[model samples]
Target: MTSTTERPEVEPARGGTHASGEPADDLLARHRAVAPSWTSLYYEEPLELVSGSGNRVTDSRGRTYLDFFGGILTNMVGYDLPALREAVTKQISRGVVHTSTLYLLRSQVELAEKIARLSKIPDAKVFLTSSGTEANEAALLLAMTYRRSNQVLALRNSYHGRSFATVGITGNRSWSASSFSPLQTTYLQGGYRFRSSFRGMDDDAYVDACVADLRELLAVATAGDVACLIAEPVQGVGGFAVPPDRLLGAYKEVLDETGTLFISDEVQTGWGRTGETFFGIEASGVVPDMLTFAKGLAGGYAIGGVVARGDVMDCLDANGISTFGGNPVATVAANAVLDHVLDHDLQHNAARLGALLKDGLGAAAQRLDLVAEVRGKGLMIGLELVGADGYAPHPAAAAAVLEQARAGGLLIGKGGLHGNVIRIAPPLTLTEDEAREGLGVLLTALEAVDAAQG
Candidate 1:
């Protein structure tokens, strides 16, 4: 006897409407219902991006905007590069997406060799991971184990990543969710200058003051056995806060005396984004003990790694493995990205276009009271929003500008401890035309924000 058991009707997938002609609103409603509360969304009405090509992305409603954020600086060569696509396709045909680090992978070895050659670290060795956070974790582990200390020093208003360990090192309070951490971290001064008490000082005095502060922090805040001092040459999430070009070199002097490892968090500032140097720390004329990188190297694929002095890298005695680290597909994508970055000389383009963008942004700042300062190097620029008081951070103005820019068919990013700085980091492949268009839209947005505030 065949029993007819009726199955209950299944609801549409959470965060998405059913195929029964439901509108996109249902998808958003579902999203709110199922997504984590801390998952932040941009704009008052969050956009649903569906497609992208080159430097532009299309929203669910079919409106296209020039993507200046580059998916938070991860899309190094821009979206859907023909060469990268071809490489990824070829890798996919190989029938192996992932192989645990237990086995050898040809692409991983080639990518590591290329990065080691380019890293500039003496006798460099590379270890791959799935993201910047993991790379930093590895770096921290290597440093602590090598030096046999859990004490670390980081810069104020700096951001590393969101992992438990990385967040412990992050000085940005907004991004840090918990105070509890395994490593004891000491916060130092130097990364953020605009809001510093030493802002009135000349460049030389400022550098000396920052170094003195670092020295004090190391002496007072940390025990005698500090393991490492990690810093972002250009603090990415801290609104691209850039100190004097020689700041890290100055800090390295003190670190050397203490036998502390210096780890440069180049996750955002690597791969020639800064134009003047392939790695941002190179501008300081100091070679870091270890360098952590991610984002741009993989051309939108998940890949991160640490390049360290061979001796330091070998200090980790125990077994460590990242299941998806150095996966075949990601390595291929990264290798292709490196080729494109070098072949096209994107770094030089970044330097050339960055100057034009900065000039335009400076003009906008001069015209608009809302724009307090324009700072950053190469293609990574930041505009700090301020109120009529001239020095007070204007987060509302920043929000207004973001919305205005999006409405004007431009997409950008925001950061800073107070969330008042506009982060404009387009892909390295950004052209003169695209830069001009983005600048025009940004200026218009600034004007709109000023009018709104008034």
Candidate 2:
């Protein structure tokens, strides 16, 4: 007799058909009718996820996948945990679901305190927002205003967010939606080197070269009239491109000399997902003057936040308020997430399991030439697919692997400028057996695609 949570991947006990019982094609058609054309979705036949438990999610068609992507690294604690559900339900029962930021909310204040303490910035001040875009928007405002410059510097192959402001700073053209940017953005080299002139150089040498380039670019491009240098320690949407250790530190040295600010966008890489440290940027030994977070921080609640040096955050003279920034329910959930992460020491789990998963993928990449590189720290891993020629990006291989993994009951994600890097960041609560199972499915899918392509 198996437990209720236990279900075969082929035959989920519940959630087989859409609530409306509409055909899958009709459902997609209905979505297309209401949604914008540019809204990206996964798969040839997009999966309609209905319910989840632990690391597995059941689709509308009664199939359960070992969810490796964790809802784009948002579901850090996984789905349908009793502890999480009960806490949220109790909060909802207390009547104040959303009281905005007008009044002092205990949950919100508690969350702020935790984040401030965790944030490396001294005398930190935090502002909550509804999403990463909003959090980053807040950071940008602080930096530009504090420095009184609209000019910003970001790394090539980096993604901040989707807003007009962040899109201006975003260097990835694929994720950049609009041409009109509010900031005069100067793109730098160094984060992604899959096709970089800095390729093949040793790590320290590469960092030195990139720092030198940044100095030259600043001298020539903006002449050091920049407000800040915003970067992700591990380039998340740009395919988990882990810059060499101290890369940002090297950049910070340059920024500090010019009184420029540094902002770390840890939306995907924060909250111990990077394993070795509390934040992904920690591995770089660079404490950003401003830090932005979202995605997995609030246990899947809609929340984003920015932490800044108190003086910088308070520099703005105008009165400002994010109406629904730290809603009560979301803050409660965020508090629970923090407690769980700290109590269980999931950071160590991430490091241990991340090493196991990366070892497996690295071995697969070594054996199968289809995979060009297996890079990333902790659980935020990426497997970059390539053509038979080895360097050319093979997005088709990535696509095939995604579909193949889905059919084989595993859900992974793909990113990168060319969309050729498979992103794998599962929940921090992922079990060892579960990690191995997902890894097996992923390797099989990779091998299947490699053989089919050959």
Candidate 3:
């Protein structure tokens, strides 16, 4: 591990120049002196963010930049939305700042009802938690408790959460290693067309291969004791990686035959961010026994997560109760977020804007040799950067591109097991005009990175 002092701090441009002068050296020094190095892993920007508004953030130097990252794709409605602020303020005025989910909370019930109605799940039940991790944690516990089986099978590259149970089920060994204990769970490799060993196989053959691998894993790894099979409709952190359409159907069929419940972890893609109804699952016409959501639901106002499914939810009682799961204030904020998203038709916006973004990125990939593929659905997009000499993750190139994007007034994220893919998942409310501007900035960043390499 590199020490903070050894970290290279990029200097902002000189004052009076378009970009802020090199980042303040003292600022970076102080961060090294005070903050832990782990937090620095999120970004390597020079300027410190001071405040933010809709789609724009102001740095400490008074220079503003467009926020394309959207707080790692959590702020679906942009930063500090008026309605979200008002909702939070009004709830704070009511004096129920933080209360356990012991008794009835009106906002909690109301938000739950709204989510249930919007989910189109007929009679879905909602369980609120503080973060996506907690939500996934709750879902994992419920699946294990309900089925009376401890073994759960997850995809090879899927990212669930970091909590003990969720981490055990998460396939990414790097981030999930600390929480890796001997849990009654196993991981089966999922389909990734970009790097599949069975690349030359047709779609039908690929689907058959996935089914066969899953059945073998279940028999050997789980000892035929698997309770649930959890997967993301579109793997978010693993890469903006979208699995083959037939893979979902085939996996569902295999799980059905094995009597293992299916769980969809939509924590990142849920709440209309991925267009097609709720998420990619709806597009494939597969209904999971349990669904998890979080990221865009509350629009970055406060953390909120939900698990929807009537029959499956009925399996757990006090075993899954959260102390501060459904606080009134957070619930009120969530209620307003749902109201705004539905009333403004954000799902339709997500679909339209996502197409615009996908087209832009795909065209860029075709024209640029550095780009390997443009994959993902709706607003959730990824651009894979091939290695300088090989197809592995070009971390230095990825870092350079990220810095260039930040300097050019756009923010993007990096993901994939190799951290080679640049992730672009903005708010569902992002306009076409904003998409164009962000894409332009992104293109400029890529050009600059290539130039730097030259």
Candidate 4:
């Protein structure tokens, strides 16, 4: 018998009403006509998510799915949680929706205080934005504005944002340089041991080698020229790669030696997602001068922010400001998310659930020929798929797996430099049983894809 979890919520599989109470093909055709092709990459026919509550989202076709992707890791609180809705409604009724950094807003102050308290960064100051890319853009601008320098160092395969400044710093040539010229920045390759290009490397050796390469880059990079080094603690889009335990300290020392600011882009890794207090520099016991955040901040309530040390933030205070960056409604939603994560001990849950998922995925990968490896911690996970033959991207197969999983009543995501990595970033509220269900669904999906490929 098919597992209950694998059964689609839509009944009579054919001619069924959608979650939006509309025909699925009609909705898909409308979207295909009105939306950009890029958006349609993930939104094929019969795609219409209409409602969400907790970890399940219902589509227009009345198909409910276990949302292991967590709305691309933004819905940390799941969907329509009463607390978040109430917080947003209260803020809206208060009639304080729009405000700039020039004026002090109550929600702004409260959210700032809560973030500082949670992060434990002394004299932490915040800059609010509308999205993670904007947060990264602001961080890069701030770093550039503060430094008496022109050069910045970023790791290869790292994702910062898409704005000109942040895009210049993003290391992926496929996503970045192919469309734009390199800005005033240099790329220093750094990441995990699995398939790392750097040779003669162990954990310590990787750090030492990266540090040496950075020193050389600095020497030729014009002293007082490199402004900052931005990196993710655990690589998310880069195949959920985790660095060696020693890379953080070693790189921080290199920055210290060069008097360069260190920026931690925690947009994808922050909140309770990593089973930590905050996706701050403290994860690796290294303190960054600046940190960028978004995604899980407002629990899918449209908020992003930056936390910087006093000295670094002072630079922004002296030279810059924003409008509508810290709208009261968004901040209130952010406060509610912070409260919910704390009150429910979501961080601990993330840690426990992550362990369960990772172990299960590892075993599944070992039993499956299509899977190359499994990596990630906490709720952030990735499964790298090996090519069936030549070195071509297996996007077709990956899409097949995603489609099969969707049909099986699970919502998953795709990632990696090649789009072949199955990303499993669920809400922090995910339970062990939910993880098991998702894993089983994904395993069955993989088998279907393999069989189709054969």
Best by TM-score: 1
Model 1 C-alpha lDDT per residue in residues 336-425, reported as the tens digit of each score: 999999999998988999999999999878878888889999999999899888899998888888999999999999999999999999
TM-score of each: 0.95, 0.95, 0.90, 0.90
Alpha-carbon lDDT, every model: 0.90, 0.90, 0.77, 0.78
Q: Give a tens-digit lDDT track for model 2, residues 1-454.
A: 8657765343222323463474334566667767999997899999888889988898877788899999899999999867778879999999989888888899999999999999879999999999999999999999989999999999999999888899999999899989899899998875788888889988888999999999888988995669999998899999999888878999999999989999999998899998999998888888889999999888788999999999999999999998889999899989998899899999999999999999999988888989999999899999889998999999999999999999889999999999999999999999999999999999999999999878
Give residue 122's error in model 2 in angstroms. 0.3
Predictions ranked by TM-score, top down? 1, 2, 4, 3
Leading candidate by lDDT: 1
In candidate 1 the C-alpha lDDT for residue 414 amounts to 97
Model 1: runs farther than 4 Å from truth?
1-25
Residue 293, candidate 2: how far off, in angstroms? 0.2
Error of 4 at 329 (Å): 0.9
lDDT per residue as tens, model 4, 360-425: 878877767677778887898887776665334577777888888988899888876777878889
Ranking of predictions according to lDDT: 1, 2, 4, 3
Q: Which stretches of candidate 2 lie over 4 Å from their true place?
A: 1-25
On a 0 to 1 TM-score scale, where does candidate 1 land against the true structure?
0.95
- Per-structure clash totals for the candidates: 1, 0, 7, 7
